[model samples]
Target: MEGVFDLERVATFVAGYQSVMSLESAHLADTARRLWWKRMTDFWQLEFHYDRNDDSCDELYIADEALLHWWTERLDVVERTFAGSAQVPNSP
Candidate 1:
């Protein structure tokens, strides 16, 4: 029997995965970095602020509205991609 993959659940999982592994583990550091980069690039168009003299930079914070929409779309894409991958066997 083929196992069912819930997009919503998988999306939630991905979000949690991204959150927990974003900066803590080397294994997932790259994946988290890519995700963050994509998020910033897509919405902010790579616009950012920096203080040359202070050697400080603005932090990256996702707006609530944007985060909701972005997560919804992101989860859908991730779930679909995982579902479609041959390596991820449908039943196993």
Candidate 2:
């Protein structure tokens, strides 16, 4: 699923598997949410400060926005794909 760009089908697959996995690990679901939100908010991709160039300053702070988005989306797919494994039991 990494040759050409396909968003609609991928999203559908992710959502579908996510629904199935909803019955599995609550921990992974929660973690997915956190990661999704973190990437959404902390999108400081390709940020560079030429004025303050130093060893401490990173040439590329974080990933490019598009790359980050793709990464986040992949996480969703992964979370859904493997959501059935190592599920935590629900409390009584």
TM-score of each: 0.24, 0.38
What tens-digit string does per-residue lDDT give for candidate 2 at 1-92? 33222444444555677776554456655766676678567624323354444434453343345545565656655454334442222221
For candidate 2, the 10 contiguous residues with the lowest summed lDDT are 83-92
TM-score of candidate 1 against the unseen true structure: 0.24
Report the Cα lDDT for candidate 1: 0.42
Please give, for residues 1-92, the per-residue lDDT of candidate 1 as tens digits: 11224445544565566666553334343454466457545534224433233322323333433554544455534434333322232321
Q: lDDT values of the candidates?
A: 0.42, 0.49
Worst 10 residues of 1 by lDDT: 83-92
Please report the candidate that would top lDDT against the real structure: 2
Error of 1 at 80 (Å): 5.0
Clashes of each: 0, 0
User: How well does candidate 2 match the true structure in TM-score terms?
Assistant: 0.38
